[model samples]
Target: MTAHYTSQTDTDRAATETATAPAQRDRQARGIGSIDRLAGRRILVTGGAGFIGSNFARWLAPHAHVTILDDFRSGSRDNINDIDDISVIDGDIRDAGLVANAVRDQDVVVHMAAMAGVQRTLDNPVDTLEVNVEGTRTVLEAAVEASVDRVLFTSTSEMYGDLFEPPYREDGPIAPKTNYAVAKAVNERYVKSYCEAAGIPYTILRYFNVYGPNQDGSTDGYVVPKFVRRALADDSIPVYGSGEQTRDFTYIDDALDATIRSLGPAGRNETFNVGTGYECSIRRLAEFAADVVGRGHIIHTEDPRPYRVERRCADITKARGVLGYAPRTPLPDGIAKVAAAMKRSDRQRAREV
Candidate 1:
C-alpha cells in the first residue's frame, strides 16, 4: 500500500509552498494530462467562481476562451478574482436573458450553477428547485437556442440516496431524498430532454464526494473540508450519525479531467460516474484530517439533516472505459493537500490582516 503522507524534507516544503499548493504539487507528481482538444473553443461555466467550477475554469482558461457566469451566492471572488484572460460575468443563472447572453456564441456550456448542500437545500427547497432545476432549464434552453456543440450537466451521487449498494453505477435508479439531490435529478432529465428535442449533444457527470482547494468549509457541506477546518483550528471534529457512512471522494483535478473529457467526441451524449470508486468512512475521514493537524478530539452527534445517506461509492468503470478517466488522488493524499491549502490560506489571511 502507498503511504498516506509522503515524507518531505523542510527544503521540499519551502520550495513547494513558494511555487505551488500541495494539491497542485500532488497533481504534477502524478503527471496527469489535460484534454488539449478544447483549445480555441469558447466555453461558459455556470457558477464558474465556485469551488469546482472555478478550478475547472482556471484549468481551461489557457486552452479555451473561458467565461464565468456566477452570482457569487456560494461562490467566492477570491477563487477566480485574480485569474487573467477569463471574462467574469456577475449574474444569475435563473435569468434566462443573462444565461442567453452568456451562452451566445459559446462552443460548450458546463452547467454547474446550483443551490448545493443538503441542509442548505432543506432550508430552501423552493430556491433549490428553482435555481438548480429551473435554472438548468434556462441554461439548456439557451444552449439549444445558441446551437452549442456540447454541454455538460453536473449531477450528484446524492441522487442515489440510501441505495445501500456498494458502488452506484451510472445506470442505477436514483431516489433523491433531499431538495438538492431532487433538483439535480430533475436537471439531468431536463438536459437530456432538451438536447434530444433540439438535436443538441449533452453529457451528464454524476460526481461523488469532490474535495479540494477553493472549497469553503464554512459553506460547503462536505465532511472532508468541515473536518479539516475544525481540526486545523484545534476544534472538536463533529461526526454526524455513527460516522461510519462512507463516500467515494474524487479529487478536484480528477473531476476536472473527467469533465473536460466529456466535452470531447468520446463521451458525447453519455452519462458517466466521476469518482475514485474507493469507500472511506466519515470516521476515518475525520481521523485523517485530525492527524493532519495533530488533533485527537472528536464529537459525535445525531444527524439533524432531513436526509442522510448511509453510504455512497461510485462505479467508475464506464468513465474509465469510455473517457479514460482514472482517479489518481487517494483519500489520504487529497485530504493532506486540503490541509496544506487551508493552512496556506490561513497564513495569507494573517499576513493580509
Candidate 2:
C-alpha cells in the first residue's frame, strides 16, 4: 500500500494519483479545443467570489466576459480583486434591483450564492430559505428580465441527505436533513420551476464533495480541508461519528469543467451529478492529510451528530452521458495539491509573523 493510500489496497491504481495539476492547467490554458465556446459572451455569475464561484471566475475569465456579483457575504476579494478584465460588482443577490443590474445584458447567469455550510444552515434556517430559495428566485427572475439565454443552478448532494445507497441520482426524492440542504433543494426546485414555466433555460448541478485549493475550509463543513488545516496545525484530526461516513469526493477542476459544460448548447435544464464517484470515509481522508504533513498521529473520532450520518456517493451517469464529465484528478493527487497550497499559505502567514 502507498504511504498516502490506506492499508486496504485496491487493484485500480486507476484512481487519479500521479496526474500533474499545472500540466492540466497548461493544457486548458492553451485551449481545450471546445472550452472557448462561451468566449466573448457576457456571463454573470452570482457568488463568483466564493470558493466554487471564484474557481469558476478564474476558469472562465480567459474564455468568457465574466461578470462577478458578490456582496462579500462569504466571498473573498482575493477571488476577483486581481481580474481587471472581469467586472466585479459588490452587491447582494437578495436585492432584486442589484440582481437585476448584475444579470443585465448577460448571455448566461450562474447562481451560486447562498448561506453556505451545514452548521450555519442549521443555526439559521430562515436565512438559508430566504437567501438560497428566495435569492435563486430573484436571480432567475433577473435572468428573464435581462433576456439571458440560459442559467445554471448550483445544488448539493446534501439535498440527498441520509441516502444509504451509493451513486445518488437526479430522480430521487428530496430528503434534506440540514437547513443548508433544504435551501439547496429549494434552489433546485425554483430553477426547475422557472425553466419549465417561464421557458427560461436552466441546468442544475448537484455537486458531491468538491475539494481544491481556493476552498475555505473554515467556511465549509467539508471533511478533507477541515482535516488538512487541523492536521497541518499539528492538532488532532477530529472525526465526528466514528469517521464511518463516506463521501464521493470530486476535484474542483472536474466540477468547474462540468459547470462550463452546462453552459454549452448540450447543457440546458439537464441536472447532472458532478463527482469522482470514489467513496472515501472521513477516517481515510484524515489519514491522507496527516500522512501528507508527515504527522505521527491517529484519527480522533467523536460522537456522530444526529443531523449528519450516512454516505454520499454520486451516480454520475447523467454527467457522463450529457456533459461528457469524467473526473481526471485522483483523490490522492487532489488532496496533495490542497496540502501543498495550505503549506504555502502557512509559510506566507509565518513570514508575516
Computed on alpha carbons, the lDDT of every model, listed in order, comes to: 0.82, 0.76
- Note the residue pairs that clash in candidate 1: none
Q: What is the TM-score of each candidate against the true structure?
A: 0.92, 0.90
lDDT of 2 at 161: 75
Candidate 1, which segments miss by more than 4 Å at Cα? 1-34
Q: Which ten contiguous residues of candidate 2 have the minimum total lDDT? A: 7-16
Candidate 1 local lDDT, 1-353, one digit each (tens):
11233444445434534656655555433313445777888999999988999998888777789999999998888999778899999998989998999999999999999988766777887888889877998999999999999889999888898855768888878888787888888888898999999898899999888888657688446778888889878898988878887788888988887887777787889999998888877877887777655664788988876557888888899988988877886666566677778888889999999
- Scored by Cα lDDT, where does model 1 land? 0.82
Q: How much is the lDDT of residue 49 in candidate 1?
A: 89
Per-residue alpha-carbon lDDT of model 2 for 65-177, expressed as tens digits?
A: 98999889788997677665798888878899988888888988988888887666667778878888888888988887777788888888887777547667788766778
